[model samples]
Target: MAARKRKQSPQHEDQREKVRFYPAWCKRCGNCAAFCPQHVIEMDQWGYPHAVRTHDCISCHMCEKLCPDFAVTVGEETPSSVSRRGAAGPSPGTEGSLVSQDHSPERLAKTPHPDEEEHD
Candidate 1:
């Protein structure tokens, strides 16, 4: 007897991807494919890793964190965020989370330098 195959809708099968791999920076180390908890990634014959079952990705960031070349990224980049990828500033909704307000200009200006302290 043949096993029954589950029917999946086109929309369901085409789930939005939560992980991305940069081909240029990838060294084909296979760490991302090995470390993926859901087996969402697979290695090609040429030792390159690619997402096989992207629908199963849980956005756990395991692949991204394990990649030695930093070739993997596990989030959708909004237009605004893409332009500010490396900008130094507080992310959205984290404005008041800092206990010491370290990023605030006023706090930084008032903070004393350790080297400038009195010797006595």
Candidate 2:
């Protein structure tokens, strides 16, 4: 039997404010979907959350606060209005750590494999 393709909602330009999802960093924890008051976010076939109802978003920042992975960002679409979490990385006091604090000798001894490179 052939593998069935997952159905994804068709993309559209609704002129709503911006909501960004960093899939690489997303852990698919579903907290964003569970906490959204407007029911805007929906889990994709792979269990990652996507903004299915972008127009309904009210910039409540609930998803921003609830995400343990720091994957979702809610902000307005303006030159001045940048990421809810600063452009560099997650803001202070977020659920996840911006940098890994494990500084044990074992951790410091580990090194990345030569063949592997970080993705963009």
lDDT of the candidates, in the order given: 0.60, 0.58
Off by over 4 Å in 1: 1-16, 78-120
- For all predicted structures, in order, the TM-scores are 0.54, 0.52
Where is the poorest 10-residue window by lDDT in model 1? 84-93
Model 2 ranges off by over 4 Å:
1-17, 77-120
Per-candidate total of colliding backbone pairs: 0, 0
- Per-residue accuracy of model 1 over 8-81 as CA lDDT, tens digit each: 46864445445655544566799999998888888866575768676667789999988998767777765533
Per-residue error (Å), model 2, residue 40: 0.2
Which one wins on TM-score? 1
**Residue-by-residue lDDT tens digits, candidate 2, 1-120:** 111233334443542445676554566789999988888888866576777666666789999899987667787454323432232233222335243423232332233433335531
